[model samples]
Target: MGLASASLFRTCGAYVILAGRSEARLETARQRLGDAQTLAFDITDSEQVTEALSRLPEESLDCLVVTAARVTHGPFAEQPVAEVREMFEARFWGAYGLVRAALPYMRAGGAIVLFSGVLSRRPGMNCAGLGAACAAVEALTRGLALELGPRLRVNCIAPGMVRTELHDRVPEERREAMFRSTGESLPVGRIGAPEEIARAVLLAATNGYMTGHVLDVDGGHTIRQYATRQ
Candidate 1:
């Protein structure tokens, strides 16, 4: 998803910098984009995030987009606190640290795009920690927008299930079946594509009037869930 967002920005003529924990993956993604800079850093580590952002010139950054997430699934009663903390470390603290580190580099009127998930609003069994973590991100988005307003815009995109490498661990048949079921359940009649989410991110970043907003790029998932409940 992050790669898709970076590619979209590059296509739109913005100078892009791809950052991740894997130097090899970042290089490969950079090559795929023809030409773009790369930064290798562990986002969950505050010192690493600070060091990475320090490389950028002060007031040179025009926008910051965060799409990385770590998902944990299990009943609340069964899940250990340590495992939940790990999820928060990746999904929540990572974004928090990135925003703090990147602020000095961001110019006036800059935008920050953060990602949550549909589960934050639409409940799912066995996703207690995931939902809570996503909700926390949404809260952070609102608080940051209010705190940094007029000078900088902060917003979030809550994406639904999308076709991304995150599902590679699942067996082919199982993954396909899950997608098929999910697609049929959604009002759009298909699962989302990474490019679809990327387009939404672009809109959020470029729309000067949008701030303190949580845009749901979730293929009618929330509406369908609400309707079924009704």
Candidate 2:
């Protein structure tokens, strides 16, 4: 997700800084991006995020985009407590902490683009906790949009299933069929690509009037899925 967005932003003449928990990944991104910089830090660590922001040469950041999320799909009754904790730490608390730390470095006219998932509003078996976490992001986006308005614009992009590394965690038995079924189920008749979602992320970040909104870039998945559930 971050890589796709970074590529788009970088291509369009934005000086990009890639941040993540993996030095290897960051190094790879720096090589791929050629001219961009990379910062290695755990978003869940407030101190680390603050230190990272401090290292930036710019006195004020123009945009902040939080696109990190990991979710495990399994029956709620069988879900491991550790994985659930990891999800909240990475997906929810990580965004919360980063924003709190990064806000100090961003001036008015700055914008925040958050990532949410279709499962937030379209529940599925074995995804209750994952859905809850995404739903929290949606709520947080709206709340921050309202509270930070006139200074900072906040919004979320709720994307449908995109072909990304995140899907490697889906149970092997379900993985292949899940994508097939999702492709057939969505009104667009296909799962999304990372670049497709990246386009929407760019819009949410650059658009001055869009705030406090959960823009659905789900290819009609949420609404179509909802209809099936009923």
Candidate 3:
């Protein structure tokens, strides 16, 4: 989703800076982007985030779109406490710290687009930890929008299941089957594409009056349960 957002922003003639933990993957993505600056850092580490942000060449950021998260799924009882903490460190604190650090470099009227997931609201079984982290992000979006208003806009994109490399860890056959079944179950009759979610990020960034909003780019995943109800 980050890559897709970067591509879309680049297409719109924006100078894009792509940040992630993997130098190799960031380089590959930068190659695809052709004109983007890449910063490789562990967002989960505050020192690293600060150091990375310090290296940005631009004087002020017009928009900051964050799509990095540590995703974990399992029953609450079965989920390791350490793993859950790690998820929060990466997903919640990472975003919080980055935004705070980047505030000095953000131009007035700039936008900060954070990422959550549909599970934050329309949660399923075995996703308690993930849901909590996502919910925190959404809440932070609203709070920050109110606190930082009239200068910087803050919003969140809560996307549903999308086609991304995040699922590659699963066996290919199983992954495809999961996607197929999920796509069938959604109201749109298909899962989301990364590009679709990217479009929402663009909208949030460009729309001046759209602060403190958690825009759902979920392909109707949030409404699926209600739609299926008798």
- Which window of 10 residues has the lowest lDDT sum in candidate 2? 221-230
Model 1, residue 176: distance off in Å is 0.9
Question: Which whole-number lDDT from 0 to 100 does residue 2 have in model 1?
Answer: 86
Taking the candidates one at a time, how many backbone clashes does each contain? 0, 0, 0
TM-score of each: 0.96, 0.92, 0.96
For candidate 2, write residues 1-230 as lDDT tens digits.
Answer: 88899899988888888898899989988999889878899888888888888887654678888987677768888989899889999899999999988887786898999998988988888999889999999999999999999899999999888888888877877987888777887888888899998898899889999999998898788768534321
lDDT of 3 by residue, 1-230 (tens): 99999999999999999999999999999999998898888888888888888886544799999888888888889889999999999999999999999998798999999999999999888998999999999999999999999999999999988999999999999999999888877888889999998899999999999999999998789888543322
Winner on lDDT between 2 and 3 is 3
TM-score, predicted candidate 1 vs. hidden true structure: 0.96
Q: Candidate order by lDDT, highest to lowest?
A: 3, 1, 2
